[model samples]
Target: MSLRPNPPCLNPQTPPPPQSELDNIRRYDVKAIANYYRRRPWKVLGRALEVLWSFGFFLTCLLWDQWTHQVEYYKRQRAEDLRELLTKLGPTFIKVGQALSTRPDLVRRDFLEELIKLQDQLPPFDNDLAFQLMEEQLGMKVDEAYREISAHPVAAASLGQVYRAMLFSGEEVAVKVQRPNLRPRLSLDLYLMRLGAEKFGRFLPLNLGHDLTLIVDEFGIKLFEEIDYLNEGRNAEKFAENFHGDAEVKVPCIYWQYSNQKVLTLEWIQGFKLTDIDKIRAAGLDPSNIIKIGVTSGLRQLLEHGFFHADPHPGNLFATLDGRMAYIDFGMMDQLEPGTKETIASSIVQLINKDYLALTEDFIALGFLAPNTDITPIIPALENVFGSAIGQSVQDFNFKTITDDFSELMYDYPFRVPAKFALIIRSLVTQEGLALSLDPNFKIVEVAYPYVARRLLTGESPQLRRQLIDVLFKNGKFQWQRLENMLSIARSDTKFDLLPTAQLGLQFLFSEEGLYLRRQILLALTEDDRLHTDEVQRIWGLVKDDFRPQELVNVAWNAVREFSLAGVSTILPQR
Candidate 1:
């Protein structure tokens, strides 16, 4: 609530009492501003220039509506321009772009594709400046700390620049040195965003949770954590620990003694980015196989383990010499709260089974939809695209298909994805595209299906299960009830207006509308006869042929059997 956060401890974590010549230099109180700004008025005026640049953002969006067609054709161009502008504007603005890039649900495929280019591409800081910052943060000169520091930064961005370096023992490492002055700039940028979101809130829509306050707060937290490389160090360590014995995935070990708020030192890993098909091939590895490993492992992290890398682009992921897949940059990791992981897992399973009702419930549980909205239309809308039955599931639907469908649908209404799980969800969805790039037949769902099935059968983290139930009841209840009502009408009435019945059943089968009704049918029928699809279809035909009894037992049996959910819940992953 205040401009300043209270120190995490009674005594703050800062440089220890100055001993060496470097440490003897005045340490700027991280909590207190340095004299540079107050001592000089020009710096204050410079901040004003930044403020104007921040306000200039509206000019771009003003043309957003006008450039509709151009936006599509020139997506890459527009996104690169935006990324450059974001970088120029600094971390707060870059943060906005980064967040938007990871949300394919809220953006178009091309747009998201273009935005990924921003992740590791900011102009590098002067190597001399980086050396100075490293010395300032580590309390030692460059030579005192490392045997050889690459003056040329291997990677650089808003908060830091990474250099390939060698420690005293000759171990090669990568060092991330924070910019000389970052906190003040970030705070100001955040201030501008806060002011902007507040101004925009007067017309903010309900579904977006359009709380600029919350968005700004989250950004602040992320930015602060980003600067504190120590936390990132821990995250990488934890991830490495998780996959310790397994050789398929490797997270670089953190060199903690040299890591601090402004400088992070870790083992430098050698590999090619996941997207570089040629390099992966040149390394005597199958790009397709590596893609498989990336997708499946990512799914396990999000839906099973509840922790994941927010950005899994090629720049942040790679295939090591031994064919081990490695993930880097823990600066942006997302942790699914209780129920989220399960909801996502269940949603995928439901989609695979073409259980619209299950997906609807899952959506509701995950808080993607309101608990009280009419789900009749959405259910049928899904079936219109995905079809209904066990084999013809949404999971069978490929990434390109989803991109096409969601792209059109999103134009009308922003397909809602919860804010907290935004990064993880988008990463998984984009992974489909990355996989398809290497091999045309690569289906992210196919790759993820085995892990999904394994988790479902073995039971997942509690968070995932909670989310599944939430979707079924919390958000999809009305649709379920409506489905129940439709079935009840068809069962009891002599005059069966079957259009409403079929449509209602279809919608209920596909999404929010029939989630509960389908669940009810499955639980009820499974209890009675183990969910015979032929029987289900036979029942459908019986409802249709009740008046015209033309010896249709065989047809009814066949249809129900074909439609019976046999092995629908069964996982099919061609691993």
Candidate 2:
């Protein structure tokens, strides 16, 4: 069967349903699709054949160019061809291309540059069809629902196209209408792709350490969620809730009355894309500060809230005129379990410590390795891959370079990216790419480490506190320089609490969990039973400037008063 375009069929306009009916729209469920197409053999076969016809020739051309060693000669042409082919294949392929754009290790530079155009540059579908679909979904005339709306789409993307509209209340909003026939097209393509992966894996010489079909399934699940406009609205609200009271971050409010399964209405933002460095500067905002906000917010999403916006391409992130960072397009989102979040945070520590053995364990804990897999040989490979990149100040580390090297390592070793981590890697890599686009010298680790440092120093979570202890004391010895560095970095964060940190330090120093820390401090201050004041003097010298004279007196008075009250009670309060 040869693939051909399907004109969007229009559904008859009807009256708007009640809120309860809209809420009943099917939500995202990955398990429901696991064996979803087993009975539809003919449908799967037809779609599979259509896919083969569409991509088979392209793959053949690629293999031929490689075989003749002429790939460099025709690279640009091949890239253009690949982009057009994916676009022709519809939303599913377009999404896959966008995901591939961030992977430097998987896709070459020329092809990656081309694939990036897929992010927000896809061709718009028929505007008339979009209007028809909106009316059908919202059960109201376009003019009745909006005071004014764009005659044409303001922007077009894989799953939907966006229109600028105004409410009757005089508020501006961006109305997103889903592409016609998106669900069935996506469903058919995903099944065919999964089946192809399963069948082809038996013969292909590829060893990516992960099952390709599982990756396809993961992609399908997220894509399904993305197509549901209602789910996207909920994701935006939840993201706003997580970032409540954050002055530097902005999330648009959803207009629930005008939104449903096929249409999304939210506050219209007038801002420049973070990648637009020139406009950002013209608006009197520092691009560097904007980059910091992006990286910091991304860290909070992944490490702190365990929820993250997976697709953070240039289009989805904006710099508002007021100098705050605004995030849009909440369609693609993911969450990490609490344990998974802690493991990822610990992986960062292992990378910094250059403990490849522990890092290997982290990968296993993250599901990149099987429980019974032998990691003895993988440790040295990991050390070789990450040692130099992280050996210097972590600021010298580059994500793209590391990813390229790691990709090769995955092919050679037993390393496979877990299905859940696909978007995490994509998000991190895209953020780095976005930063580099704005500033060639930008190092994501520089901005990212400060947030992590603040979390470690001031976070009250028991798990995080334990990790901090591990970072400070290793092999029964205190790492004073590490402590000093952590404090220095954390001090730069505006939210870092100086007094609370001091209190926490004292509490840890005297608590049971602080036994190891106390012993290490004692060892640092004494040698062969002779006490030395040099260590204590150096510490006081480092911290003396941080304490005001009045603050010191207050702390003294509080301690003395408590002690005196306890003594009086012991001696005289015998009743």
Best by TM-score: 2
By TM-score, how accurate is candidate 1? 0.68
Put down candidate 2 lDDT per residue, 120-218, tens digits, no spaces. 998999989999978878778899989999999999999999999998888889999999877767776876777678888757777767677777777
Residue 253 lDDT in model 2?
79
Native-structure RMSD, model 1: 13.8
Question: Per-prediction RMSD in angstroms?
Answer: 13.8, 7.1
Model 2 spans with C-alpha error above 4 angstroms: 1-42, 63-73, 372-374, 492-497, 510-520, 527-533, 553-575
Candidate 1 structure quality by residue, lDDT tens digits, 78-100: 56666677777776676677667
Error of 1 at 506 (Å): 36
Candidates in order have lDDT scores of 0.62, 0.79
Model 2, residue pairs in steric clash: none
